[model samples]
Target: MNKKEDSPSSLDLIWGVSEIAKMIGRTERQTYHMIQSGNLPMVKQVGERYVASRSKLIAFFIEDAA
Candidate 1:
């Protein structure tokens, strides 16, 4: 099995794109575009899903607000 598969499925420190979008009041497509445009930090791909760091997302909002 690959190392990724060997890793734990439970993520304690990250959020998926949909979850982050809901928190930030943006659509999933918008979030994906942000990632594509480098407006938002890149995400780590897990299987077929993209995951973002919760802390990073919070920081992004804080920076944007500043």
Candidate 2:
């Protein structure tokens, strides 16, 4: 087995719309609007819900800050 395989990855952790909103201090409704407006990237969709990875969201903030 590889050492990498033994460790958990933050990138593998997924977050839903509400979690993300709480992280960024926004309301769920506003988060949804951000997704629809192309401000935030949606990594996956399940029925009516949106999902995003923590790493991707951090990258978004980094890029936006630059």
Lowest-sum lDDT 10-residue window in model 1: 5-14
Model 2 per-residue lDDT tens digits across residues 1-66:
787756566445556788879766799999878888888864567777677777777887888889
Tens digit of lDDT per residue, candidate 1, span 12-40? 24567787677678999998887778887
List the candidates' TM-scores in order: 0.66, 0.68
Candidate 2 positional error at 23, Å: 2.0
Alpha carbon deviation, residue 54, candidate 2 (Å): 0.3
Off-target runs (Cα >4 Å) in candidate 1 are 1-12
Give the runs in model 2 whose Cα sits over 4 Å from its true position: 1-11
